[model samples]
Structure formats: structure tokens, C-alpha cells
Target chain A: MDGEQQYIKNVDADAELVDRARAGDLAAFGELVRRYESRVYRTARHILGNDEDAEDVLQDAMLKAFQHLDSFQGQSKFYTWLVRIAVNESLMKLRKRKTSRTVSLDENIETDEEPIVREIAVWDDNPEQRYSQGEIREILDTAVASLKPIFRTVFILRDVEELSTEETAEALGLSVAAVKSRLLRARLQLREKLTRAFKRKGDQILGYV
Target chain B: MVTCKDFLRELGDYLDESVDPQVREELSKHINECPNCWVVLNTTQKTIQVYKGMDPEPLPEGVHDRLIGALEKKIKSQA
Candidate 1:
């Protein structure tokens, strides 16, 4: 295989391992888990917004994938199939833990958007630049997080994961047109947030810190 | 033959290699003539680049063991 085709094969190779695992091959199953554990957990974490919930979602999704592996025909990549499972698991977890979420759609409260999406660490900087950067990251994160779930998912799958629209559409069961539309909205939203974030951070650093 | 909006609309498709050759050729010609279109192209390119640069968060600690354990338990029960 050429480099690109070889890379694709590396991903497709999971289908073979999955097939073996379905035949009761424990080692094959383990290999599959090792290959995707981090990515699955990370996707869950981002969608669910907490490590505890992310872990639960990952466990649920992995178990489900193992159980349903017999039905996988390799039409979609293993990772894509796995991600769909994880997304469902995370959303289900969110529904289950609905009461615990700090965010409520009904409340028009003026919550700070930045800190909600990203954790802020103490800055070692002379206190000014550090605060500024953290503030920017916060706004960027919040702006990203505020996107409607569908739009946000498209952004995550396409931009962050570098999946093409067709792949994203296949994974999410969306049309290619839907994926493109949502992706454009997501990007425009992020750009607006980033612009506002940097400007505000710049002003704050010069004035307050 | 390509305008700024047309270029932006086709840009993603072009990057994904889903655009037809005619549109691609038109976009190339437009890029050569239009500074505004060039800026949009540059910004969109950088946006994708920055996105790719962000490090994907790793799996939560012990995710492998947890998944494997869960899978084993579920599969065994089914069997």
C-alpha cells in the first residue's frame, strides 16, 4: 500500500480483529480495546463533560460494540462505528444524570461561558499574560461548547477528528449536506467566539491585570 | 468564474476531493485574481490547521481495563 492506502488499512485492520473477537478470541478483543480505548474515552469525555461520566459511557459503548460486532459488515470503519456507540452512550448518560448537570436550558442566567467548557489552571506567569491566555481559552471553550449538540458534533467529528463530511455523515447518520451546513455554522460560531475572546482578554490584561 | 461565496462554498468539498474538476479549475483561477477570496481561503485553512493541532485528550486512566472487564462480563453472560 502507498502511504495513504496503508494508513487506511491500518484503520480497516480493526475489522479483522473485531471478527476474530466475535469468534470468542479474547486476545483479539483485547487488541481492539487497546487500539481505541483512548479515543473512545476522549470522545465520551468531551461530549459528557466529566471524567466519571465519560468512563461510564466508554465502558457501556465498548461492551455494546463487542456484543454487536457480529452485525458489523465493515461498510463503515470500526472507529466510526465505535464512535457512534460512544456518542449514544454519552447522550444516554446525560439523560440519566439530567438532574446533576450544572447547565439548564431554561435558565437565562448570565453564567460565564468560558470556565464552563474548559478547566482553568493557575497561571505561573507574572499574573498578567497567564490570566489573559486562560481567559481566551475559556471563551473559546465555552463558545465551542455552547453550540447545539448536532452542530457541535459535526464540528468535533470533522474539524477536531479530521473526518471528512461523508465519514461524519455516515457516523452520525446525517446527510452530507446536513453535515456541511452544521459544520459551517459551527466554524462561524467558533470564529466569532475566538474574536470576542481575544479582544476581551487583550483589554482585560491591559486594564485590570 | 468563481466568486468569494462560491469559493467558500466549494472549499470544504475541494479539500475533501469531492469537487468536480471544473469547479476546482474555476476556484484556482479566482484565487489568482481575488485577494479577498485568498484571505478567506487562508483563514479557513488556518482554522483546520489549528483544529488538527489541538492534542486529542487521552483516555481516562484505566479505561482499557474497565472496558475489557465490562466486555468480558457482558459477553460471558450472553454466551
Candidate 2:
């Protein structure tokens, strides 16, 4: 099916599930949880930075979602609503611990008047070819972890969860301009991390040559 | 013509297809002729692509079962 058809199908399915769940069909609720648990878990994990805390947020968010199923008006997709809960729950945990790292979007990248050419290097090997899947994931996870929570949350929502700019902004309670700014910074930071990794790998290859 | 600075500033919007047609055309033109900006744009695009392709870490089976188990208990209590 085309994208629109698939979206409609998913909406239908979610509506059915939500209706069943609202009727106190625990199995139906479980099905909803099954569909979104991984995504919720990952978002929590990225936000909280640990599996134990993520697990706590996961259960708390899901339980809260279950308890408040009546509040879900179907105006938004169920998953989007659930993600907002998960993000809020994770942030709550961060607040409790007083460990939320906020990065300023106003921070400017140092740009030279003239474009610098020497810093750019043509990567010889595809990153996928240069690293194993596990290694790449580790590198990516570490890189994402390095981002400030604001940028990281934006990155995870927009890039990792594949939410749209509007959805991301709604989830984080930010303006579209703020989402775009943070997302650009997140992407640029991640690119710098990956580029450094690839440049190091390229240097190693040159040594062997 | 869009300068490298102008192109970099709009790079995200260009990739997102949110920029106006005229701005996109200018950015595209600049990237085509400027290798430095091109590499930056290319690598950044690749980075996003790779990140999007990376699999989300699956919820552990134990955690999954435990969550459902806990939720079931909560539902039972409410009932």
C-alpha cells in the first residue's frame, strides 16, 4: 500500500485498539503496549541515560497511560500521545535527580569569513563497511549521549522516533523554529562525531598503504 | 548566488524540503560548485541517513514481560 493508505490503516487499527482498551480489555491494552513499548523504552533510555531508569520510566509511563486511557481523545495518534507521556515521565525523573543538562541554542558555530577547504576530507570507505553494526550503534549511542538533553531529545524524537517537526515540537512543547534549530545542531554535532571517527579510520588505512 | 555561509545556514531546511524554491535552488547551486560545503552537506546527510537506519535497541524480553506483568496486576486491582 501507499504511504497514505498505510497511515489510514494504522489509524484504524489504533482506534480499534484504543476503543477496546478503553472498555477495559486488558489484552487489547497489552497489545497497544507491545506495539509501542520498544519505542517508549528507547526514548526513555536516551533521555535518562540508563536502562534501570529507563525501565522505571517505561513502566511508569505505560501504567500512567493505562490509567488515563479515557483522556486520550484520538485527536492525535496513540503512539504520539504515548511518546509525550514517556518524554514527560523521563524529564520528571531527570528533574527529581537534578541532572538535566540544558544546552543553549543561541551558541554559535565559529565560522570564518572564507570557507575553509582543508578541514574537509573525502571519506574513502562507507561507514557501514568500516564498522560492524554493533560498533556503529555503540558509536552512535555514545555520540547521541554527548548531546545536551534539549538537542538530544529533539534528535531522538525527530530522527530516531521519526516524528515530524510538528509532532516533535508538540511533544517537547517547543516552537517549530526551536525544533529546527536544535535538530540542526544535533545533526551537526553527530556529523562531527562520525566524521572524526571516519577520519581516524581513513588515517589508519593510509598508514597501511 | 548563495554564499557558503548562507548555504550552511539553510542546509537543514533544504534537506527538510522546507525552504522556498528559490532558496533551495541557490543552496543546491552553491553545493554543486563548492566542494567544502558539498562535503559538509553530504556527510551531514549521510549521518542523518545512517542514524535513521540504525535499529532501535529492543526492549529486553525480561523487561517486556515484567511490564506487562505489572500492568496486569494494576488492571486487576482496578477491576
Candidate 3:
């Protein structure tokens, strides 16, 4: 494996780092961060929806992880444990912040606010087409940004980070039913956004009401 | 009448394959017979497929490194 892949594999294993960190090896703890930093940061970013807050949450989460490292017996994977800490810390920070409240669409709505829709189109893999990737990613970023903090956290953990429902429930301190409920709602909201965008773009020329 | 709206409301669970077998069997039967419900099911299914296709946004450059650095610093200061 290349150095990058090897590093990723090491992180995924969570073996060497857990053992070393338990023994108070600072470098091993650093490796744990290397392994899960992006996930933690992204989860924070999605929940908090601001770079500065996400950064603060990331720092706090790191500190908490370090302080509580001893309690992390290998029952669950290291990332799951770490993520639970990070997500809870991030959500706590988010709750403390004064953010606007958004509505959850339990059923279809009649509003014109086009939910930010991300189109995941694959063209021939060309480095020059990086612009397209940025556009689609921005759409997803916007869609995520539009969600309520709790739903955003659930979606980011489940869909983006690929955490299972049970793990996500543990991380967010939500029941499995709550996780499933929020996930279904989040998926519906995201779908509405994309559907509106596609329909608008496709039927724009017709100009029908 | 089992309206399309009702079908759409349960569409999330149906798509997840989370509905009970009895409900699933009934819904399948309804969708098979009812064009409107079927349309709703098709649209909802296609919409979910599209959403799931979205790529993971790569983390901001230096984010991982910065996080690791911050973590290491915290661990060191405590030691």
C-alpha cells in the first residue's frame, strides 16, 4: 500500500494506536486524531454549520477524547467511541449557540423555496472537471446547511460517515427510533430539494404553472 | 380509499424495507393495482436513489492535520 492508503488502513485497524495511547504514548494518540479528524470535523461542521464553531468543537472533542481515553475499552471500534464523544460535544456546542430554527417537512409542501439539490453526475474522470465536482459538492453543502442541526447531525453521521443506526443513536444520545425517524425525515427533505431543482430545470422552458 | 398521499407518507419505511411483512405485502399489492400510488412510489424511489448518489465532500485541506496537531498538543499539555 502507498503511504496514504497504509495510514488509512492503520487508522481503520485502530489497534496499534489504541494500545499505544492507553500506555500514554502521545504519538499514538496523535495517530488516532489523524484517523478520525476529518470525520469528527465534518460531523461538527454539518451540525454546527460554521467553520469557526466546527473548529472549536473539534478542539473540545479532542480534549475530551484525551481526557476520557482511559475509559475507552475496546468494546466498540475506536472511531465509534471517538465519534460518540465528538458528536455529543459538537451537538452540545450547537445547542448553546443561537442558530435559526428551520422547519421539518413531514409532508410535501407548497413553498417555492427550492431545497438545495445536488446532482451527482459522473463524467469521464478528468482532472480538469474539478469544477463540476465543486459545484455538486457545494449543492450538498448547501442542502446540509439548510437542515435543522439535529437532522443534519443524523444525516452526516449516517449517510456521509456511513455509521449504522444504532451507533448513530449512541453518538447523538437519541433512541434508535429517533435516529430512524430523523434519518427518514432528513432523506425526505433532501429528496424534496433535489426533485424541485430537477423539475424546475427540466420544465423551465415550458413555463407552466 | 388508500390515497397516494398515505402511500407517500409510508414510502420512507417502505424504501428502507423497514415496514412489517404484512404492511409490505399489502403495500405491494396496492402499488401493483393502483397507478397513482405506483407513481408516487416510483418518484420517491428514484428521488432516494439520486440523493444516495451524492459524493462525500472531501474534508477541507489541512483539517485532518490541524485536528491531529491540536489533539497531540492537548494530550501533551495534560501529561
- Model 1 Cα lDDT, one tens digit per residue, A42-137: 677666667888888888888888778888878888888888888777766766777675332222422212111121121222323545645544
lDDT of 3 by residue, A83-201 (tens): 88877777667556644643332223322232221332212223224346666566667877898766677787877777778888877677786777677667767755544444432
All models: lDDT? 0.66, 0.81, 0.66
Clashing pairs in 3: none
Q: Count the backbone clashes (under 3 Å) in each candidate.
A: 1, 0, 0
Lowest lDDT 10-residue stretch of candidate 2 chain A: A200-209
State every prediction's TM-score relative to the real structure: 0.74, 0.88, 0.72
Deviation of model 1 at A22, angstroms: 1.1
Angstrom error at residue B16, model 3: 2.8
Q: List the residue pairs that clash in candidate 2.
A: none
A85-158 per-residue lDDT for model 2 (tens digits) = 99988887877787455333333433332222233544545766788888888888999999877789999999
Model 3 / residue A101 / CA error / Å = 7.5
Q: After superposition, how far is residue B39 of candidate 1 from its true place, in Å?
A: 3.0
Q: Please give me the total number of clashing residue pairs in predicted model 3.
A: 0
| Native contact fraction, candidates in order | 0.41, 0.74, 0.26
